[model samples]
Target: MSRNIPLLDLQKEFEMLKPELMPALEEVLSSARFIMGPQLDELNDHIQSLLGVKHHIPCANGTDALLIALKALDIQPGDEVITTPFTFVATAETIAFAGAVPVFTDIRSDTCLMDPNLIEERITEKTKAIIPVHLFGQMVPMEPVMTIAKKYGLKVIEDTAQAIGATQHGCFAGTIGDIGTISYFPSKNLGAYGDAGGIVTNNDSLAETCALIANHGQAHKYEHHLIGLNSRMDSLQAAILNVKIKYLEEWNILRAEKAAWYHKYLDPSVETPVTVPGNTHIYHQYTIKVDQRDALKEYLAGQGIATAVHYPIPLNEQPAIAALKLHGFPTPVAAKTAQRVLSLPMNQYLSEEDIRYVADAVNSFLNTKKSQSFQNSPTGSSV
Candidate 1:
């Protein structure tokens, strides 16, 4: 029987951390404080120290984190927020949810990040913010984005759902922009046991606003200043994350090692991920570009090797975005990318032997396709 490898082996991760995890959970349970408890406060302090971010505000999930950010920045209806259309919908959805128009931008074919060059043309008088999504485990080139934001006098929100520890020029992903949002989705690099998220900022006012916005806009008891959402992170999720945070860097490093194995073992014909200059890629997804991506995914599935498409469609072309009646932009690269991008099994738990097995399966399929194609061509002269 073929061995089955999963895209994210969270169960294995949980087993590895269970020693500390159980004790932490016991402590949270013993304290009987579930909401914004000591565990959450401790996690906040640890995150601030670990990432060197000035302010950390915990939320229910990444989407709320983004929404909190937009509301904190006072983004109004009809305002425009420029962002790439290639990433998860939450990056764009929060903009629309905040009653702002999402201005679509193209992404770079190599890094699949919002092309800074393509951003200026999309900026309009109504443009209020630029959301640079750090797709995968890599941080987008923030300097150029920051420069553009400064020039346009627009707020910058780093959609860092997939890139928590990722850094650019030694600065953490969410800290470079005006505000950064993170998701603790189970599949993320620093994921929690349940839904958890955070907002980070260097500005004290933005920090305060985020905290208020996340907890129903009550600075003090029953003193509502602005409308807000009930998006506070619970104690149990915080306790779980606290146990996992210590291993985050180690896991990120291991993921990079696993990515290297995929490169070394896979056929050279395959297009692997490319890390942007001055960026540290945590390989949140070891995605590759290939012809007949769906076929390859199905082949891998049959081999008991799981695979995924990080995104199979661009946001601008999606039914929901279309419903907004938003003007379309030239997203040729993002559109092409949606059809070709495929993510292979990637986790710290994957061993070299596991990777080798998966790679052999991939090479076998591609090589066979090549052979068949050659044989069918007019110039074929197979033995």
Candidate 2:
């Protein structure tokens, strides 16, 4: 059997960092202080410096990061938070978790981030914040979102889970908003060995508030300030993250190079991905628009090239959120995007040969159009 191409190859990344990573892990293990330790503090400082933000609060996962941000801002039940539908459910899920209603906004057909133009129509007295997710490692056009937030007295929480290092013009994704959340989940650009996430902010008070909330609402040991969740990043994950942080810029540069290679090589008929105007893309997933996404995905699998759909369902249509009773909301773009989006193999570890192989596999799959076989044997292996 031939080697299968992985959607993301974390083992290759791990091998690259083993020399420095192992020692860090050893030190954390020796300390035995798993929760809030020196490793966590170091990783927080490293992320803060890299993103040029004043405060970094380490959390257990990205979802908790957003929830903490919303909690810190005093967003409550019945408050409306505007967000795009064409992203991971966590963006909206966290809004609901914050006890606020997620007002679904349409996305830009090209960029797939929140359509800043459509925001005003959704605003109402209940509106408290706008979460413009930096989807697929590209910064959501922050200037317009910020302007609208300023005009309406709305808070902006940047869902930067997929765009830790991505920027628009000269501004970084997480820093542009009042607060931002990033995931260091195994698949992220700056991934940890396991699940990990962080919140970044320029405001000192907001940072302290989120940190307190993440630690079971305690500002000090055994003292509960408010009802909060326990969501602290483990020392082991932080130790791994601290080692990886040093290589982030170099890895992001390689990812950019691979994205360029894909652009140069992938078939033009495939509707290759496009970046938001004036925004830098970190190519987290390298998603392309394909008319026959399911068929092509199957064909690629047959060729040992793994592929995935970043999101196959729009958030508004999710069964969990249907009770909100949102309808006739210009969801055509989101629906179409769900059917058409296909993520190709993307990681800093992919070599020139791997890039060409995946590109060729996609173009070949498109040319062959194996519709019947795909329909007949649609396996659930796009992991």
Candidate 3:
């Protein structure tokens, strides 16, 4: 019988780390450090040293990280924050959550990142920030985004939920902007056992503000500085992250190896992900653009292979965003990619054999459709 392949099999990874994780979790329980404690401090130090950032403020989730970053930057009501609509809802939702308008920008057709060329036309006097999402494990070409931001005097927030350790032109994914937000949800490249997040910045004042906003605006005990929310990552999640952080670089390398296998084995018909110049993709999702994405996903499921669509709908087209009554620029590329992008099974533990199986499944499906007229699919794969 064929084996069942999950989109991400964290259970195997968990089992591998069981010994270290158990002792760490037990220590937190025994010390009764359920909330902020030594564990969080250690994790922060670990991340700070690795990323070479001035501060790493722990938070409850990635959404809170973005919201706190926005609040710290003083994005006021009616202020516009530009971001790509092709990303997860959290990216734009956090802007609206911070009482700022989410101005949608179109994405690059090849890489699906926010197009810097389209950004200038969207900026207005009300624009305060630009959020470039590092989607599917590759950093957006941040040089142009930063240049445009500096030209417009707009703050920048890097949404690095998927591309934690990814780099563009030697700068880490989260370090290029004014502030960077990370997600430690279990599925991330550097995931915790549950919900967790952190903020990274080189500026001292912004770091202090983010820390305060994430902790109910407390400057000191019983002293309120600004209106803030209670959003701190717990000790248990921190403890889990402590053990996992050491292996992050190794795991990302392994994931890249798995992606290579797919690239080598997939048939010529399917379009593979494109990694831009001077960028390292961690392959967080290994998304490919195909004509019949839903059909391929269904066919793979029947073969005990799991696949996922990173975002089936652009945020600007969603009803919740529509309810906000916000006017968004046209995002035809985002809308077009949303229907074609399919995330194949990608994880550190995926073997070459597993990749071949998935590629074969994809090729078989495409072969079934080969007789029909094909369009808009990039080529360059050989099985």
Candidate 4:
């Protein structure tokens, strides 16, 4: 029997772009400078220009980008960084990696992004920074989050992992915070062939620090400045990104169009996704909440449709979170969201027929109360 549709078809993406990609790969192979080469520099310059930021430091991956940003801000042991538990593990894991504690801030139930209003309540003497994840490509309430951050003198790191080209209130998603991190994972909107990540910042001091940290703490050859990790972006990956970056806007537009279709065609029995005001989303995952998430997912799978869960367990409920055990985190919204949210197969390459098939399957499943066979897996790779 033939299989159901896969979540994303990277092979198809490559096939469509092979003409442009082949030459770039050949150029990189000819240069033979694999690390921190001209290709990487060119890609960084392109990202900086596109995002309207001063510095765009390319790194090994998104997780490392966040780690470097935290390190640059001088986050250390005993410092508390406020973040949402409804996002990918990397959002909080980077804070922990920087020897800081990730204080779980709940999300807005509607947008599933961090609730800026709740951030102040979590801030304490130990709170040194706030990392608001732009979850599912929707911008967080940044104007309010920034106001709270400025009042408290805390660094803000926007985790734009799933929202590279997304915009809000006429400004880009990654440009709103002091420092922003973006992933070029294979499945992202502007993903590369393998792992790649970039950090954007307007602060000169922070940019210098991030660059140094990603380069083994080296200011010069054999001259170590600070303790750091080896997290440089490779030239080959940069070449791949250079080719894809040009199409990000168009591809994201396609994703947005597909999302609109889903929103219009979703079963009346199911609750649809919520879009925040003044946000122009890229629709990274096109996620939605429903009454019977697992059942719906399975039903879709049986009908040759694929679905995923952005997160099934809130951060507070995770085994890694028990160690911190903060008093009264109150993740009621995050916890409830974890159980009901589901992500349909969303990609720039998806067709109108594909969207209709998935929607029809969903409506059918919801009506008959019959579920298809599928694993209720978490969306984030680390999870």
TM-score of each: 0.98, 0.94, 0.96, 0.94
Prediction RMSDs, each to the true structure:
1.2, 5.2, 3.8, 6.3
Candidate 3 per-residue lDDT over residues 200-251, each given as its tens digit: 9999999999999989999999899989899989999999999999999999
Residue 306 Cα positional deviation in candidate 1, in Å, after optimal superposition: 0.6
What is the per-residue lDDT of model 2 for residues 8-55, given as tens digits with 9 covering 90 to 100? Answer: 888887787889989988898898888888998798779888888999
| TM-score (C-alpha) between model 2 and the true structure | 0.94
lDDT of 2 at 57: 94
Q: List the residue pairs that clash in candidate 3.
A: none
Residue 192 of candidate 3: its Cα lDDT?
94
Best by lDDT: 1
- C-alpha lDDT score of every prediction, in listed order: 0.92, 0.87, 0.91, 0.86
Candidate closest to the true structure, highest TM-score: 1
Tens digits of per-residue lDDT for model 1, 136-240: 999888888989999999999999999989998899889999999999999999998889899999999999999999999888999998788899999999999
> Backbone clashes per model, in order?
0, 0, 0, 2
Report clash pairs, candidate 4: 298-372, 299-372
Superposed by TM-score, candidate 2 places the C-alpha of residue 340 at a distance from the truth, in angstroms, of 0.4
